[model samples]
Target: MDYFDPAGFCKVGDEAGFRNLRAAELKHGRVAMMAALGASVQHYVQFPGFDEVPTGIGAVTTAPGSYGFAALFLVSGVLELALWTEDPKKEPGNFGDPLNLGQYDIDMRNKELNNGRFAMFSIVGIIAAELFTGKDGIDQIGLDTPTL
Candidate 1:
C-alpha cells in the first residue's frame, strides 16, 4: 500500500475544499480523520497477506520491520467538539452515528499536528539522549568470558 506523502499533503489544503475547516469541523475534524487513518492501519495489520503487501517491499512477516504510529490526541479531542458545535446549516447534535466517526479531512492541520514536525516533541528529545549512550564494548567480547 501507498503511504502518505508529506510533499503532496498540501494538495488537500485548498480554500474551497477545506475553507475554515478548523471553524467548521473544529476538533471533530481531526478525530474523524484519525479514525479513518487508524482503520487503514488496522486493515494492514489484520490482512497483510501477499495481495495486501505492496510491490518491491518484499513480504510482510515478522522479519524486523519498523513502523511509526503517532497522532495528536489533542486535535482529536478538539474535533469531538467541532462536529457538534454551532453551524448555520447544521444542528447541534451527532452529525454522524455514535458508532461511526467518519474520515479525516486530510489537511496540513492534521498532518503537521500528527507528525513530529509540529507540537511538543518532548518524547523525541528524550529518546535522542540514547545517542550518547551507545552499546559500547559489548560486541568486543568475542564470546562469553570466564566467570570471576
Candidate 2:
C-alpha cells in the first residue's frame, strides 16, 4: 500500500511518536508480535520433562509455576497500577472503581500466563529431545564420535 511518508512530521529517536505514528503503529505491532512469539517459544524450553507427568495430570507441572508467577504478577501489577496508573479509587468519574482492581489484576495475570505457554512448549520440546538422545545420563553425552 502506497501512502504518504510522514518522515517530515517524524523526528529521529522520538519513541513515542515513532510508536504512535500511523506507519510505525502498524509495523510496531507486527514486530512486537513476532518478538513476543519468539520469546515465548524460548520460554517453553525452560521446563524439563514437564510433559513426562502423566497424560491427564502430567501437564500440570508447569501449571503451579505459572500460577505462582501469575499470583505474583497480579499482586505486583496492582501495586504498579496504584503507582503508575490513575488512582481510580480517588477519582470521581465512573471509571474509578476500586473493586475493579482485583478483576483487572486477574485478567492481566492470566494474559501473562497464556502468552508464556509458547515458551513452555519450546522448552519442553528441547528437553524431551535431549533426554531421548541419552543426554539424561552422565556417563553418555553428545553422540559426536564421528560414528555412522
Candidate 3:
C-alpha cells in the first residue's frame, strides 16, 4: 500500500520500461488535456461555417465523418512514423523545447506529468458525465446558471 502504488499494479521492472511508460503517459495526458480544452471551448466558440454542428458529444460524433477520420488516420500515421520516433538516449518526455521556453528542470517535468495525469482523468469524467446527464460540461456542473 505504497502512496504511489496502492494497488501494487505498477509492474515496470526496469528503468527502460519505466521510461517508456512515462513517455506513453505523457503523450496520452497531453492529448487528453487538449481534448478537454476543445470540449470546453466548443461550448462557447466555433468557426463561422460550423454553426449547424451540434454541441458536446454530438459535435464530436458528427464533425469527424468518414473522410475526416481517414485524414486524421493518415496524418497521425505520418506524424507517428516521422516525428514521434523515440530516442532511447533521451529522457522519457524530453522532446526538446523548440521555443526555447527557458529552463525545464525536474520540478517542471514532474508538474507537467502530474497535470497531464489529472487531465486524463478529467477528460474521461467529462465525457462520462456528458453521456449520462445529456448535458455539456458547463451545464452538467451548473455553471450555466447566472446570478446577480
Best by lDDT: 3
User: Model 3 scores what on Cα lDDT?
Assistant: 0.75
Clash count for candidate 3 is 0
User: Can you rank all candidates by lDDT, best first?
Assistant: 3, 2, 1
- Per TM-score, the best of the predicted structures is 3
Estimate, for each residue in 26-59, the C-alpha lDDT of model 1 and write its tens digit.
Answer: 3444444444343324323433332443211222
Tens-digit lDDT string for candidate 3 (69-104): 467669978987899877888877777878898767
Pairs in clash, predicted candidate 3: none
The C-alpha local distance difference test score for the whole of candidate 1 amounts to: 0.35
Pairs that collide in candidate 2 are 40-119, 43-119, 44-119, 44-120, 44-121, 44-123, 45-123, 53-58
Quantify all predictions' global Cα lDDT against the true fold: 0.35, 0.41, 0.75
Clashes of 1: 6
Local accuracy of candidate 2 as per-residue lDDT tens digits, 1-148: 1123455665766644533453333333434444445333432333453333221112233564555456756886786467534322431111234676555344553454344445455445544654566332111233323211
Q: Model 2 TM-score? A: 0.22
